[model samples]
Target: MAKKADKYFKEDKWKIIEEGFNPDYGMVSESIFSLANEYMGVRGYFEEGYSGNKLIGSYFNGIYERSEPDYNHYKGVADFTEYMVNSVDWLYTRIEIDNEQLDLYKSDFEKFYRELDMKTGILTREFVWKTAKGKRIAIKFERCLSMTEVERSTWQASIKALNFNGKIYVTTGLDFSNIHRNSGENMWNCGEKFIQADKNITLGIEGTTINTGLKVSSNCKIQADYESMEEIIEDKLVAVKLCINLEKNKEQKITKIIRNLTLKDESQKEEYEDKKAKIKDGRDDVIVLNEELKEESRKWWENVWKRSDITIDNDIENQQGIRFCIFQMYQTYNGAVKGTNIGAKGLTGEAYNGNAFWDTETYCLPFYLFNDREGAKNLLYFRYKTLDEARKRAEVLDCEGAFYPIATISGKECCNLWQHASLQLQASTAVAYGIWFYEKMYNDKAFIKNYGLEMLIEISRMLATRGDFDKDGKYGYYCVMGPDEFQMMVHNNCYTNYMGRFTLKYTIEKVKEMKEKYPKEYEKVVKKINFKESEMNKWKQIIKNMIIPYSDDTLIFEQHDGFFKLPHVDIDSIPISDFPLYNHWSYDRIYRNDMIKQPDVLMFMLLFNSDFTKEQLKANYEFYEPRCIHESSLSPSVHSILANQLGKEEEAYDFFGFATRMDLDNYNRNTNEGIHTTSIAAAWMNIVYGFGGLRSDGEILSLSPTIPKNWDGYSFKLTYNDEILEVKVNKEEVTIKTLGNKLIEIKVFDKVELINDEGYTYKFT
Candidate 1:
């Protein structure tokens, strides 16, 4: 056995590099170096297009198209809905010299390098190539999506002739041929295109889906120093050509300014304007747009890094990995818009079909809440806006309350699996938990009165309908799925039951508060939803008798009904190649036997740490971790956080390493499809919640910092309750400082210290 080398471009506190070209790893690198601005994302494929294996993707957060055969089942159990469709390909460039096209694969090329500058949210590539006809040229390119403008991006390419003085031709365009790579059906239909040629070239194309009927438009204008001409070639491809005569060692540069707009951006149907007119308006401002966007994007990233940056002092690999995870997570979604949640693959690639999942509430929301509270509020607002759809889904399932979909684009359940999509039920609880988590830290009563209380009440109502009293008079849920997808149709899943109990209890409290504080709002909600006043008694009854499975002998909670009765084979017994049993064995075989894909019971215990004792946590973690295959990228961070809490530092670091490198090292061997967007946020959790031991209990923020053995120290900033605080831990002492002018109290290793408006630092000895 041999250890694999860590893959990255370079070791910097602030930059991500793909040091040299790895054509074999081209697609993976594209995912790693992907760029986004919370609105749109583009993968890092070559600008001078390659015929090699790659997914040329550009995505908008809410622009999607529908597909048929969503589920493999025979019954009409699934809904016909749109998944996030891959948008236009805006990075097409064809370079030719002396009648030969410049293909990196076929040419003599060297000094190939690519970098994603985190500081400015820009991606750059540089290389030198010798054409087959013996003409040598050097090329450098830079690209960025604007964070300030939110709808604009720029790509600039500079070409220099080193040895030959001859004619050079370049073709650049907004391409729709490679819009989607789906196998089943066309996700987008070509609609209309408009082009104009002058000193600069302007092109616009719009498409509507056959199923969803949502319209999306992308427009671009090219600016260059050479003579350029524009044309519409294939009804789908809009191209601009540049011709130049270059002298020895002379350089020529071309830049494209692009703007993307979709109907999703419109607040109302009548507000939607003509796509052609919008395209023309964008081109009219092309002179100063690129430079202005560049500066604004830089400033936005600067503020983001100031508030969210985490610095690991000694380990460069893990340091870079941690930052890369944070960078990508922020790039994917900033919680900018209401009614839009992050996808499993984000905007980077089309994997998971760009449907929102429970991962957004459970794994990704905390990151945004801690750094960008308004963004976090917007994410929850998405769920709030979709509440009516969830209620309708609950009716279809014959459940009493809203049944949040397992995966969705427009609030409809797109996943076909009955157990996963319909019965996982904990997803509803997760949304409730997110609300509670936010309210506990911020205590925004207006939010609860206006939005949060209604959601909690509906979810709690669902739980009351979903569960029943058993023969032993214990209320419990049956035939459900937990976080561990390997197990299905199980009874009394502890995670689901406990979270249901928590939601019911929390909802009761919030309703009482709402009635006392805002009687008018409470009455309005009651009238709007037809919520029964007597449902309170049902919620209390269910909460009082919720049966959570546990084992007296093992001192650990059971994952579900009869889980221990199965023949258990520890993961160590399986061959390394035979691991991730889902890939190697039949579903029935893996299902009947005991092999945990991730920590189901342990995850519940970790999230609700105060409920369980340390000894109990250790017992359950020890029992389940060895059996965990960690097939889900979401697995390792949970294990890592629990390990750190249980004082198993060695195990904690190992699991942290696994999570931090999940995408960077392609540990799951699936990075080619897309980076695991949720897991990236989980990696950040491993550092802050795991190593930093940060916890909030509705009153005070607390930390029990434990420095990793290999590191000198680590520091991170968090925005808590509208105040910024920094926590830095070294071998000997822990220091907490408030960066804002607000009085705050935080418990350090169980000791409370007050930081005042004067801004003070508290040191623990």
Candidate 2:
């Protein structure tokens, strides 16, 4: 087996390499090599059977099941409701030779190789297998979830006889018997099952949920000369088997096209018609389907890369890491489905119960805002679609306006923890921030005129009602959880207060703008929400008097009220085994100890960097950084961007590397459960926001490009104000080029430069 470091980079920049097979790491590899196309995803498992620890997960977005919650003293929580559940298990196949099954554990394997090609979105594996009787056969397999057609998955296997060839049988079908579960028990609890078999296909299975009444179906079309058979192994376990014959020293190939469909939002007739059309639409030959779809998939990826690709000339590892992140981000969510937000685990796994988090708005939206404007708008549109639910959530909390969920599937709060779900008011603010962020990025006022303004107003109303007079007799928020979950139930959280204040002030400004420009719309909103002038005055009052805790002696903002008074403990004092305190410590112990889970004040500084001085940024970063454990996957990328701006190059690289390879390295030891979907976007942020040094202040765009202390250079393209600009930085100089024809002025490290209509190359030495 090759060392883990070797997998970071190879000569092929587009491929992720897995050197040798180990049963222990099989599930981890499944996550890192998972393939998805926004609608459906398939885990990267071997076509031939493997008796090992594996989670064979195939998921469809927005399709879910109902499960009863074990409420622990929480009021207003639902008794029995539907949430996102693991849909089905689709990756099932077995190869047999002379009735001797070819399993990984049972057979001797040599010369094994596995890789996931990011550019092509294909996973390939090849190995040589030898049976106990000295019979040898070489097998190669290729798999992909079609990017062009989001509902279909294609799998192909090629086998050749080396020593002896009597009969080679490949049994490929869908098995719902074994699926992924966090605990020992099954989560799906799949109900009624039905199968249909005919000449055009081998087998098809359709099932309905017990409580949700949601129907899921999996059908396989096999293109091979094989005998078809079906068996009901156990009480309800069913599988379809196909047996084939092979000549000596002759090569045989088979392709299995699997189509998965769900009746989540569609009627039964529409579903059947759509399935029938898809069944007859593609070619009968699997090789032709593979080539044709591969070409279309290549073109689709090319269009995105041309506008958003980045190149790190000095480091191949970082280059691969950045592309991997971008590829996965696009694969996970492409803004096709409205009112559907991304889960923390994406379609890759069932961890977090397939619930979305605030990470989508806070960490993931910026990537889409710059590269895919439509995608960014869809994310906000989802929030708008769920506004009523947010409002209901706020009412449940005895507050006004909307209170966004910490983790949710259909916009209802799914998190059971009180501190995380209810008290994290910043989530609602983050949704509002995303609206303002998208408008700022594109300078599009239509968004505000259409949907953004209403969202802001409701969120601001919630913030105003949630705040009260603190110990100092000043208006501020209390008993809130900030970005750092380590410090729970604290008063006057700096990030929450500042963001709340900003939300109030900004919404009031927009309200006035609407009243002046679009009076009818403004009046309609006011009438709908029953807004009174007195409430606006109260918002302004709170915004003016909101207190942000800061220490004058240290020239840095305190994370929250009385944060300095906690029992201060250095992270190094903890043992290595107790590294992640969440698993080892009780909530009471974790709350009082002065250990930071992630940046709190530093995150505030990064968002509103211009609000603070460089000295203050440095002081706050230095004070809070050593205490941080970076347990959350979202932590390192924020620190990386800050370190780059603060001229801490070494620290910047360390944090950047940690985030870019988070899943590949299995740093948190949770990749087996799922990949960190939201953190994947952070990799792009570390480049565009860190090394590229791109920042926007209203209508003015600025860059302060800095090269890491490595080798040659790095460059990336971004869309700003509907114009594309490519920023490249090297050891000695920085250069900016305009890809679109436009006259503009931008600041390069605080110096204004003019870019003419023909485009300009501004070089700073």
Which candidate number would show the highest TM-score if scored against the true structure? 1
Which ten-residue region of model 2 has the weakest summed lDDT? Answer: 1-10
TM-score of each: 0.96, 0.92
Q: Scored by Cα lDDT, where does model 2 land?
A: 0.76
Candidates' RMSD to native: 2.3, 3.4
Model 1 lDDT tens row, 555-605: 889888898897887666677777556678987776776788877998878
Query: Which residue pairs collide, candidate 2?
Result: none
Q: Any idea how many clashes model 1 has?
A: 2
Candidate 1 Cα deviation (angstroms), residue 252: 1.2
How does each model score on lDDT? Answer: 0.81, 0.76
Which residue segments of model 1 deviate by more than 4 Å?
1-8, 70-76, 79-81, 228-230, 265-271, 274-278, 281-288, 551-554, 756-765
Instruction: Point out the worst 10-residue segment of candidate 1 by lDDT.
Output: 1-10
